[model samples]
Target: MTFTFKKAVRSESKLRLALEGISGSGKTYSALRLAKGLGGKIAVVDTERGSASLYSGLPGIPEFDVLELTDSFSPEVYVDAIHAAEEAGYNVIILDSITPEWSGKNGCLELADLYSKGNSLAGWKKVTPLHRKFLDTIVNSKCHIIATMRSKAAVSMVDGKVKKVQDKTEQRDGTEFEFTVVLSIDRDSHNAVASKDRTGLFKDPEVLTEETGKKLLSWLSGAATISPEIQAEAEKAAQLGVESIKNFMASLKESKPDQHALFSDAEKKRLYVVARKADINATQQGK
Candidate 1:
């Protein structure tokens, strides 16, 4: 076999965003808001009961589907959920609280413990493959993946004075490294900081919202340039006729694929619905 080399090209890839925060840190609400910004059909792999659905009716929050994984947090279960979401045509899959799958009840750690009995070194062998599979699924999935992790305060006795310490996620050590962006949220303030970002999208702490999600998308798509005139016309056409809107989207994709990322799947869906209504009304009038 001969070794080959080629010029590096930009990879228009999906995102893997990890949000870590302690309980009451608004990680669930924030993640849903971000997912709304991601566009297309959004699905949540819910583990904390039905908590993901509670914010459904909030303003700016789009309606989304959910799959509850309350039975077990096994690694295989996570793999299954990723496949199911991909098969269902969801553009974004929010794995809310991946923490449980790693360390919570019935998770990988438990399985390792059961198999190893007392041998610490042997325990990892049982769990490593399971973790690798799940991680591979998250990294290689076609859809955008956002995972939330539960965090706990890291406390240590310093000079005999107990003080609140830095937050640590319940996931395996170095789990944050797998994600394209790692956001650490303050439990009380609800502020988020991009502790790690491959895209250089979020440099400082900010409140995570739909807009934040949009900004990240823009960066991911190379911040494509679209003239003001074309954008205005596209918006007008989208409002007036369904066929025109479809044509407009098609033209954008062909001419400026980068700018096409500007429109979210949710926005496109809403416009399509309006266009369909107009067509129906027009047909009735003609008849």
Candidate 2:
């Protein structure tokens, strides 16, 4: 294979941010505030039972759309919702408490347990791909993403005294590396400290607000360029035949009518073509 290189340059990009905190640390509100600052049509995938909705019409909080996930927390379910939101033209999407996707009922953990059937290692082997796909969906999404993760209080014994400390985030380990920014929020003051920041905007711990998002947006604005992954997907979709795309759309309309209804005609055609390409690739690999 031949190799080629080009001068590296920064381009305007979507945000992949994660907020980590215990309950009452104001992660949901903080996400909304940051989204407000980012300045776009926002959508929230609420896994916390309408918690994000409670903040609607509050001071400094802009109006936004919400899609509540009551029971199902599967990765595919989340992926479909994200696609729907992206098709609907949301500029930013808040995954309010991604914790449930990792640990809640019908989540990855439970799915692994069911798949493993008494073999833990074997179970994760089957489930890891699903989890990775979830991560990839987040990473490659065209819209900016703000995901909230729940953390527990860590306690340590210091000189025979139990001291409470901030716990690690509650999702899969190493999940922080996926985001451009990861903020750890204080429970009492709700001030956020950057555990990880690729942007270099937050140097000191401060209260998260709309300004924080605006700063991020300002930093993110640059010369626009298509990402290699998106470009590749588009190229693959272009290679697919119109008849195949139509067949996939017809199948989707029959099998997933509700999800099918979420897409516009153009989006439906594009999505079906891309999905068909993915299916063909998977079949080829299997063969």
Candidate 3:
């Protein structure tokens, strides 16, 4: 008997980073440093009051193009700008703020909790084919992406002391943590850490000062040479993270543990068919 197999499409080694935290945490500073260390070629989406000017004096950086509100504030604008950057020969692309670009329309609010909406998966649906251009040109354009997000902070009184808390911000103005290297920038010596990488190893909560950015750049520099064993671990984490989300959404549609409310009974039953295909893909990818 003869067996036939098709060649696999190779994915490029690219970096997608999200800078999260309080205002004035120096997210841009960190991104520029990362870019500087990675061979002096970088692109930035200057949404944060001209993120370009914010770092004009930084080492190894010459100048940056402003992400005009009229241009990228709309989703279509994002596609145009990213495509232009890819063609302009920048080795790294920076989206200064991704939240303002997302207009909460056509069920965009549903993805308020997932990274797809802005930086997560469900946000992907909100933007649709329009956003796919971003994923391809920005994510797959053979360049590093350093996106800065305006952090949405929750406030609560802990023992009568009002404290600002960090959580998933709203979609229209902030991004949810899910599918990138999530970093919480704070005004101090400490910064919160969350890794949402599906294609690479993820780190845990660690302090992110200027020093942390240097370490990340070092790791990113070596990502192309990651060990096979480590690669397996990262992929598993990615799958587990995405799978957990699917199950969470499924549970919300149920009054009974095994029942779904959002979809018709017939539609819910078809999940098994999709799930079987996912399993096969996972196995082939060694996830």
Candidate 4:
């Protein structure tokens, strides 16, 4: 199931990629990697600390740009920054964090949910109709967008003693509710997991590109989604893995100077068969 969003390549295609997890989820770095791969000027809307600076230094963030907001900042500043990007025709845009603006006003998503005027239903409630007017004007613009949310690791105690399950949780700081896609840092493993992706791509209940899943499935067991194109890619990676498999390769040896050997034809064939099986498994499971 190699996935390609068949949507024709619009000059300013709107993409809403999200990352959510508790602290240490490595979401920031991953966001930058995605930005680099996408290859265009991406806006880094910073509401948390100024971590975008750290991203700027990385070789991975070639097209990085920053938009900083402080405690005293207003929503218009954010709107303007996005407006500027869209008007100039940036290929990618990132709202590193959109919660702070509402959080400062003590009116985040939950309040938006509680107040009938706030949700998608009523369209971001306008007290004077000015803010609503402003928000509408922005979303209507064309910009490939990615937004990040802050998250906390939470556990529910079923009996008030026995722990039930770990959850990527969001609690309102006040009247403000945070958006989902809260990427966190890992304690030891340091791998980013999409603790939750409301749209169900690039997160747990992991949505792997078919090729990526095919290549990586040997290490996983949970549910995964793969497109046909990615499935073929998985097969290729598997076949390539064989060259490293049959070599009996040891860590670079002081005894042997520099030496290497190619995979035996037999080894390549064996790995290719194994990869094909894995691809079949993914396709059957998807059905």
Candidate 5:
């Protein structure tokens, strides 16, 4: 019901990156290279028939675990894969060719079509929420996420000749807006240019390598700060007695499931500890 303001500060956060290129532009290899530079245990959710595994043990590419999704590319399937990777302690996850989730077999497009049974508009109404949830999972995930998307060639008449140029990513329009950085890769050259770069790290098109990931990691580690609103919430939560904390959490889970889901396991543990401390302090004061 009230609003407050504070000095804006950048927090050390996980990466949300996207690589867009046509087939053979090396999205998988580039994603792995960047992950290697980012430096952590890595996992890949391969929707491209285990294509990611082919690069295993290659030079400059660190070994990574894989979860191949051969059948379904539904948003829920991707969400579950992300959670599984997070639970397994992966620091980075590469979603190789997220294009499938949008257009491939059993993807959102298919789901929409099936739901519509003839009406395209009717189908999206049912599929939109699931798609939003999938995007949210990527945005709020604890681990860094690098998603690859297939791009279609854009053609134009240049000097009365139709020339093929590329830039359009094949997912839903504006999907690039969700990522902190979006690299558009050239198929012939394998070079990448940033269509979007919130971090101000990239200036020109260049070949992606392990160093690219390392640069991102270095930038991400620069500083950290929490918002005033969250600090106030933490204080309030700490003041709650143990029983009250339990009740509050339950209520939050029921009423604000999305917000409750954002709390990492470690954060929940800290909340419990603070609440217990407050309860203990109250008991001591009564003595």
Candidate 6:
């Protein structure tokens, strides 16, 4: 194998964001605002029992579709909801509190227990594939995705003084890595910090709003009106780690009729190169 270097070119990409905080940290509200700025029909996979809808009809927020995942927080349900949103042609889908899909009722934790039979480490093996499927759904989905996660926080007495501190996400470990950006918030102050950012667009802790979404869109879009289908295809191929570029090329050739018409020959080739690079990097890291 040989390496080839070429001048870097910019390509549009979808936003994969995770907003995590303790209760009252404004995750849902902020997510809605950001989704609005991304600009397309928006949908919310509300897992917080209608909490997200509370902000609906608010003064400045735009109208969006909401699919409430009540009762069970199953991973399969979350996956299906995302797929349905994409099929419905929504531009952005917010998974409010993906944490429960991991640790809540019938979630990954239960699935792991069913397979593990007592050994926690062995249980992970059973649950990992399911979790990976959900992550892949997020990475490969056709629309921008913003997920919220609940964080554990509590007060403790240190030297007879009370203070609050951050704790782990209610979801399982390593879930945060699935997102391109992860924003953590202070529960009381309602300020956010970009704990993880691949784009380097955000700065220190601050409030996130529609303007934040606008800023994100500025970088995500350029003169090129990158079609949503192309973005979806690139993200999926990159994250799936498909080994054969030839097979990927075949898939692109057979894209949906509309997408096929929209993507020019040069654009197809560019997207393939990008997907190939992403797959190669994913393969290397997995090794």
Off by over 4 Å in 4: 1-12, 71-74, 105-139, 155-241, 244-287
Q: List the residue pairs that clash in candidate 2.
A: none
TM-scores for all candidates: the values are 0.73, 0.73, 0.55, 0.52, 0.72, 0.71
- Candidate 3, position 113, lDDT: 42
Q: Where does candidate 5 stray beyond 4 Å?
A: 2-8, 154-164, 223-287
Better of 2 and 4 by lDDT: 2
Per residue, candidate 1 scores C-alpha lDDT tens digits across 1-287 of 99999864334678899998877888889998888777899989999999999988988788899998877999999999999999999999999989889987779889889878799669889888899899999999999999999888766676797744447679899888889999988765688887898876565567787766766677666673346877787778767789989998899778865566555445667778877888888889899
Better of 1 and 6 by lDDT: 1
Ten residues in sequence with the least summed lDDT for candidate 6: 256-265
| Model 2 TM-score, 2 decimals | 0.73
* Predicted candidate 6 versus true structure: per-residue lDDT over 105-154, tens digit per residue: 87998878877877988988877888888999998887899999998887
Cα lDDT tens digits, model 2, 89-130, are: 999999998898899888899999999989999999988898
CA shift of 257, model 3, Å: 53
**lDDT head-to-head 2 vs 5, winner:** 5
Residue 64 alpha-carbon offset, candidate 2, angstroms: 0.5
Q: Distance from true position, residue 44, model 6, in Å?
A: 0.5
lDDT of 4: 0.48
Preferred candidate (lDDT higher): 3 or 5: 5
Q: Using TM-score as the measure, name the better of candidate 3 and candidate 4.
A: 3
- What are the runs in model 1 whose C-alpha is more than 4 Å off? 2-11, 154-166, 224-287
lDDT of each: 0.82, 0.81, 0.54, 0.48, 0.83, 0.77
| Separate clash counts for every candidate | 0, 0, 13, 28, 0, 0
